[model samples]
Target: MPPAPASRHRTGRRTHGLLAAAEGLATAAALTAALPADAHDGGGHGHRPGRYQDVQLLSFNDLHGNLESPSGSSGRITELQPDGTTRTVDAGGAEYLATHLRQARAGHPYSVTAAGGDMVGASPLLSGLFHDEPTIEALGKLKLDVTTVGNHEFDEGARELARLQNGGCHPTDGCYTGKRFKGAGFPYLAANVQDEKTGKPILKPYWVWKKKDVRIGFIGVTLEGTPDIVSADGVKGVAFKDEVETINKYAKVLQRQGVRSIVALIHEGGFPASGAYNYDCDSPGAGAGISGPIVDIAKNVTPAVDALVTGHTHAAYVCTVPDPAGRPRMVTSAASFGRLYTDTTLTYDRRTGDIARTAVRSANHVVTRDVPKAADMTDLISRWNALAAPIGNRPIGYISADIDNTGDESPMGDLIADAQLAHGKELDPRTSLALMNPGGVRSGLTYRAKGAEGDGVVTYAEGFTVQPFANTVNLQDFTGAQLVQVLKEQVSGANAAAPKILQPSAGLTYTLDLTRSGADRVVTDSVRLDGHPVDPAATYRVATNSFLAGGGDGFPTLAQGTNDLVGEDDLAALGTYLTAHSSATSPLAPPAADRITVVQ
Candidate 1:
């Protein structure tokens, strides 16, 4: 089923190029300074008498285009109950999300729907098959007003992101649907992202939302270190700026335009101690509860900004963090996928055209499957699935049980490493073992799912979801001493604070002693290959993904490997390994994931 071009009920516009759009935003700022917008005489915008108006701010983040309900851990969220217990609630899916957002706006008149970036990329087969055109159509139907740009928005590079923003058939795919792709209804704001040649923002820096003279300004910024996490090819000609400085710069611009109420939609966030969305950071020890780059960013951002909507860390929290001026401002994240939606109410001060900071209330709400499936989103999913069926429905392999990536080490990670190892060995017969980055494993291999052909069947779509990066299996030679350093770098250098543990295949093992500090945690004597202690002076052929070969995810020592040999794409290698090794009668079981012996 070739996708029919999405039928449009509304036409949207994008602010392309920095110079002209920045000028437009500057003019908006000047107008805001001159006029006391949203002024009310102790009455509504109309002649009717009313108190301060309530502006409903509905926000979510990291939607990775999960049109269908996700399976395994990714599809669920933790909810702390009233009785001090926590329950795992199955959440997400654009179908239920649409219903929830629509029902949430039932009585609110001054409502604005927004997102904190990652609205696409790393998507499931349904949306990814059509280049996420379905997700954009769903956002338009959901009435999303604005959103920030996320690093994933640049996954296919700036040119593709522009295509998604403006309108066009994919340059390669031509047109999957009969209809032409009309980009996002909401602007993908990127205040800090600048063109390398011109030094101006590549997209709109900010967006102004006005209704009945009530104007709320929004400034969007992705993480400052986007270049480090994304593929080098994607960010080759783009430059990312300081998050705090960029947001503060745009916040002042909004204020100068007389827009007193400002919200920063950031694509970076902090981690929370508790998995429960309602876990209160207001508790005495909540400072310890929240950590990561966003903590410092929230502290330093301008006090003029009213609130912050954030993502990237994929943790959910509703907390008050004081800004530089010591004013308590709300900072919130709704986790990843379509699992959560943050419902915030802001009291709009008509006289000042600003948000009443003291009256702000926010909380993360689960998109429970109990709600009726939104018909429009279901139709959208069905349409995309029909188009995706031929290529996506092919059975790839069989699983005896779910192979998941949940903790420091995961079965799925080990499986990918093993697959890469086999492919690498085929390329260079002397390849000793393989390694994998935890972030590269996108989702788990679930044994059972809601819409599957069989209990243990893995489809081409599921395989694609797991290995969407399209990295190749790379073989290289490294001295045993440098190999030890590679393990140490997982916890040292750029990864000192947030250790990015590398997943290793069978026949390679090491002891990670968390009781020690820094590089000392990697016990040199315990590093072994094939049950033999690795000789410091010996050279060994190793297998890993191209990302690791290029020093991605802070493992810089891997970049020093000599005699590079690139093999098959990691996805195909994994699929081939699965098919060759398993069948319905003898399905693949989850790897033991015993490569790293961790001592706490």
Candidate 2:
């Protein structure tokens, strides 16, 4: 369908008046009795008194402040095939996302756009440089009606998040542009994130999207395990509660307020059996195709909640998992980085003040850039680019070729580890080695420069994309034995099925024997440092990001280290190392990732 007339729609920069639902039906009638008693039983094209109203719930998640189109592998999505294979599609970028969303909302008058969170944080230089103000403004223009607080929202801490919502110049950086930071027009709901001292949520726990007579209560929550992933400073004075319990508690609150139709914007998700967004997780033969905490949350959550929109596990899927009442309910997630948007039809019953669950349908559509980019979004990007150009365009280093984070071990991960290791030793000479988590490597460093800089030049923006998390390079005291346990933790415990192998710096080597189960896979005899067997009883100084130092990413052993000495932020270290070490004549080459000898 073509878009609504330009005059009928408002720029994302203004309030989304058309998307709100009718609020509060005082008559209190059942959905079955919603139809008028005198209504004729004849078929007609016009809306019948009893027919349910379709409320379009548009959602996307894990945007990570991608104002511009993403590059390399990060910009592509895998599509499932009937032949059981997969094909990659290039998608995402704020400009095109806006057009697709506006077009999708064209014919639907009762539509609300929401997000599952991770909208900002770990952002690219263009957005991250301005403290994600550009992204917030861009999202505002995109008409993000509502969103939850994702783990990345806490990257700079609760205080920063409050600033993002409440409007203000960065306390330190102040206002970057002539325009004042007006915060978000949309509310950031954080039902599960509570203040440790006050015992209340850090932000508004829930939000009600209201039109004249219809209301839909939205309860937003970050993952309960958020503390485990974000830096310690980010969650210093907050407590994360159980997702199911928080949602159940708020569902009752919403019910008491006469808001029967509810949606849970949860920043937690699961994996699909197939990579395709259309994969049928509910198929009898699918057999636990969609698996994760959301499954349990869906099964145990009070049936009062009608739908659960989730993120964080970035994969996309539109599935129905039975609720506590054994009634099938919608559960959805759009892939990360704005590549896709999910369109969920929530059939509302005016009389019953509840949703017709059976009629609910959801699907994820790619945000293809083939169409014209939204003029407002394009203007927003252009304005921000002018301000970010100087700093973002500076050349940091040169690379021979693309350094990608691939498979069992990645060359890019090793290079990052080596950089961190070098930076760590400069801070504390005793530091023996450094390790980089696979997930931290956001994108590959392309050899063909993205900007006007020479072919092999690495622009500051490119480097920021590769390592967006503002994590500090931390050094801590750990015994050789503890280090070994840390390596084992990669493939054991919570990571056994999905191993998050830590990329190590030069001089550190080990054999990963997949034939052996769990911790035994880390061949102890093969563990070496500078060609010497690492002594278990000997004390050593290990280096890693602050996230790992605090036991993030299931590596509990790393948290056992003592004598913390925080170094420079990881991105700074990478930038400095690249600037000081690489040149055009002799550019840095991708590491072989041979440190970890994998044996099947």
Candidate 3:
């Protein structure tokens, strides 16, 4: 299918004639009950005479292009049992996801699949090697109807994102399949992302999924703070607006156009009370059940929007956050990496032309690996693997055990920081320490073999998965005062709510007091390097990725470093460090992750 057509006018500001034309089109479309050829056969329920219509909405998010089954913890979903214990279920993989989604839509003809975004960034080698074309094609095969754009969508910048939306091969890489890319089969909504010059959405702000008389409008928006997280170059020409304002504005547009059944696809999400996919957020006395930016966004969204499908925090929850009108509305998120998918039933009230908010039901289901794999998805993965195997299978180094990226200070994060520091030392012997951003460490290195690579062997593909952004290892000079400020910044400013603790390398130790809040969390006097206190007047050279050097996360203080010197790609530095530090006789063991002394 061709890409969805772009809107000629700005959303929420259309001319009166345009609004009238839209209303007329909507009315004409609603008068017919004929199901399109591509529409699912709702098991003879298409013509059922009822006051309300049940529309199945299957949604997932933050699929970072693990076309195959993800390895390690990334592929598992926690399931809460009746006895109150939890068990880990092997989940994720496009193959199993396709099977689950197809099964979920079996008897529901009005099923529409959507996503909350991050569908194609920080991807595995199979998809990342080809700029996530395989994943995009797989999304099409899954029959996704619409999605919002996550911050990772701008990893390669707006022009690349546009190419992914529209059809074309990479401007530099050309066609990997020797055929022209067909882009996304569904519309990507970006109601909040606007062009800096024109003040219009970068993509279609909203998309309407029509099935004869059943029409559901979807408005998609990423977090307004997208610019702070993304690389400067990635979000250069676009501006991200407030999520609530953007959704509210487009909800009115859909209402004005006579399409009242609306769902807001928000890319920002909340932290649920529990990690289990089956956790009951609405249980008695669970209170809000979730917290973070999504709480306010969901509560303030106009009542015109019946439900919200959210992601980014990668937490799972199905609960009601009352809308502005004080009516409880569904808010949900399926944990990231396609491990879980939320199935929601929206009862469309025909008379009111809106959803029966009281009848809305949603739950997250794990994409269990036990199901029969979708043959087409398996074939797609095989094709991509065949192409990627040449580069992906090459052994980079060896590991003694799994270096998991979990906890406040992960072993994988420490290893990465140490690797980058070694690379920095090569460029300049005076480089003192390295700090790695938590978000940049995508996945952990599992010692077990994922492919043909033997046990304990680390392949280039695995390293790439851990660090996929192609960020450079950069060296910068900072005085002791500025360095201390950088550490404090991790808990202050934008990070105050969600502290993004930077992983510290060997010899850089500090005390983190959880009892305190904000900058005080970093014990000022306890900051040390190689057993020596950090003198306020001393200068130190630090190594960090390009993202941190430019203050990408919430560490704005890091951007103040002087004497910038860019080195090799961060992944290459990791590969070099692993090769030099490990061998068949003596493989590298997981870092102890004790650099930061935590006092809770």
Ranking by TM-score: 3, 1, 2
431-538: candidate 2 lDDT, tens digit per residue: 899988877877778887566898889988888878877678899989889989999998888677567788899999999998899899999989999999999999
CA lDDT of every candidate: 0.80, 0.80, 0.82
lDDT of 3 by residue, 1-600 (tens): 110000000000000011111111101001113333333323364555466678999999999788888899888878776677888878889998899898889878789999998898888888888888888999999999999998878877888889889989788878888999999988988999999999999999999999868889999998887887777777889999999889889988988999999999998888767777767666553225677778888878888899889888877777777788987778888888888888888877666788777667777777777778899999999998998898889999999999998887899999999999999999999999999988888889998898778999999999988888778889999999999999998788877777778899999999989899879999999999999999989989999998889877777788899999999888889999999999988999999999998888
In order of appearance, the predictions have TM-scores of 0.92, 0.89, 0.92
What lDDT, from 0 to 1, does candidate 2 have?
0.80
Q: Residue 551 of candidate 2: its Cα lDDT?
A: 83
| Segments in model 1 whose C-alpha atoms lie over 4 Å from true places | 1-51, 285-288
Give me the displacement of residue 7 in model 1, in angstroms.
Answer: 32
Q: How many residue pairs collide in each prediction?
A: 7, 7, 0
Task: Report clash pairs, candidate 2.
Answer: 12-141, 13-141, 21-211, 22-213, 22-214, 23-213, 23-214
Clashing pairs in 1: 3-177, 5-179, 29-257, 32-257, 32-258, 33-257, 33-258
Between the candidate structures 1 and 3, which one is better when assessed by lDDT?
A: 3
Model 1 per-residue lDDT tens digits across residues 124-165: 777776778888989998899999998888777898889989
User: What is the alpha-carbon lDDT for the whole of candidate 3?
Assistant: 0.82
